[model samples]
Target: MDKRSLTQLTERFRESEKRTEILRQELAAAIRQAAADDVPQKDICEATGYTRQQIRRIVLAGETETAAQP
Candidate 1:
């Protein structure tokens, strides 16, 4: 591939990564809310395809990020 094409592709990949990060944060927030609403952790895991440990970490991270907000 040409240098210009590679550069454009790299930019597009970075943009996609940024978008994915935003969506991931949104998902983490929703997961935290689900946990708080008395939803079963196993159910959440099944629905989200995340292990219990991962879910816990995501929730913790989400809480920390939220608490850091002004």
Candidate 2:
């Protein structure tokens, strides 16, 4: 491939990677919030546009926040 084409492809790949990372972080945050709020995985999936398996995985990864003491 030409240098210009190669550069374009690299940039596209980088952009996609960045987007994926952002989504992953967002999903993690959503899962944590859902857990903190006692929301079900199904509800979190609906709210966050993530699949059930993705939400389950995020929850299973132990992203829950501890309850704050008064």
lDDT to native, each model? 0.94, 0.79
Q: Find the number of clashing residue pairs for candidate 1.
A: 0
Tens digits of per-residue lDDT for model 2, 1-70: 9999999999999999999999887768767767779998778878889798877777766533333333
* Stretches of candidate 1 exceeding 4 Å from the true structure: 65-70
Q: For each predicted model, how many residue pairs clash, with residues at least 3 apart or on different chains?
A: 0, 0
Off by over 4 Å in 2: 49-53, 63-70
Clashing pairs in 2: none
| lDDT of residue 70 for candidate 2 | 34
Decoy 1 TM-score against native: 0.85
Per-candidate TM equals 0.85, 0.61
lDDT of 1 by residue, 10-64 (tens): 9999999999999998888899999999899999999999999999998888788
